[model samples]
Target: KRYSSEKSHIQGTSKLALGIFDGMKKIHGMGARERLLLQIAVLLHDCGKYISMEKVAECSYNIIMSTEIIGLSNWEREVIADVVLYNTRDFDTFEIMKQRDGMDKRTYLLVAKLVAILRLANAMDRSHYQKIQGLRVVLRDTELQVILDSARDLTLEMGLLRRQSEFFKEIYGIYPVLKRKRNA
Candidate 1:
């Protein structure tokens, strides 16, 4: 059933990606090129799902590292794979950012940024149903509130917001609270 689903219907990841992009733009002032790159990362974050759930991360990594989809360069494909692998909960951002004894700083920072955005977007769609209809941001002096509007009850939505808000907090240093519109 999952494989047969329409691309539009399977858009939870993209929606959340856009939300993160919007958040980054508003809070961190990310420019057009940066936003475009982040958007690409977000769009391809779930391409792994097409392979298998068990070790889907590894599958995605292999596919990105091997494929020439959309004519992306070898380095660009490597960046995609790195982002997918590091998006896991076990990976440490600081350790990755260190550049080790010989790793490249440019690659480390680039992958870190991609993983950060992917983490937030993946959390937003905890249900993987694309249930969230839209998201809005209200920036306060000390807090940033993200309002999520859904077509149905959002018991799962609230939980996702809690988990995903960590990324927002880390990126912007602003408190994030999720609010749903009351039934009228």
Candidate 2:
């Protein structure tokens, strides 16, 4: 499904997503399966944007739900779809849980983690320029600081991340701080 210049966008988002996951995995104790799921979800998170911009995330959720990818199992497809749905915007996690049914607490928790990671990672690539090269994440008691290694000014990313980070903060209980990598 991922190919060409579009593939690079996937690649860029994947890099950021994995970086964020890796940055937090130890602190959060993320399992390998969930990490792989996060990687797959990020890779395909934007596939629907190509078809319609107005309903990009919803479209992405529809596409992933209907189409079966090679490596993803049926439930994995469902999980990815949920991730795609939440990654598209700053949706309130509590509000979402209230609206949906049949999801147990564990599923809700996993979705929360996936969406938190995807939200911040997707927000970093908001301009689609992939201006962010790499990053280092340091977690304090209740804050996650992401120091980006980028050549371009991150005004756009910082602004967007701030807007989109509330969901992440709410779910993870950690305020996310985005900034440039300081001189060594």
lDDT of 1 by residue, 58-162 (tens): 766776677675756666667667777767645555555465423366666666666766776676676667767788767778676667777776677577667
Q: Best candidate per lDDT, number?
A: 2
Writing each residue's lDDT as its tens digit, candidate 2 over 117-161 gives 988888898788889888999888888999999988788889989
Q: Report residue 3 deviation for candidate 1 (angstroms).
A: 8.0
TM-score of candidate 1 versus the correct structure, residues matched by position: 0.75
Instruction: Name model 1 segments beyond 4 Å from true.
Output: 1-10, 94-103, 182-184
**Model 2 alpha-carbon miss at residue 151, Å:** 1.7
Clashes of 2: 0
| Native-referenced Cα lDDT, model 2 | 0.80
| Model 1: pairs clashing at backbone N, Cα or C within 3 Å | none
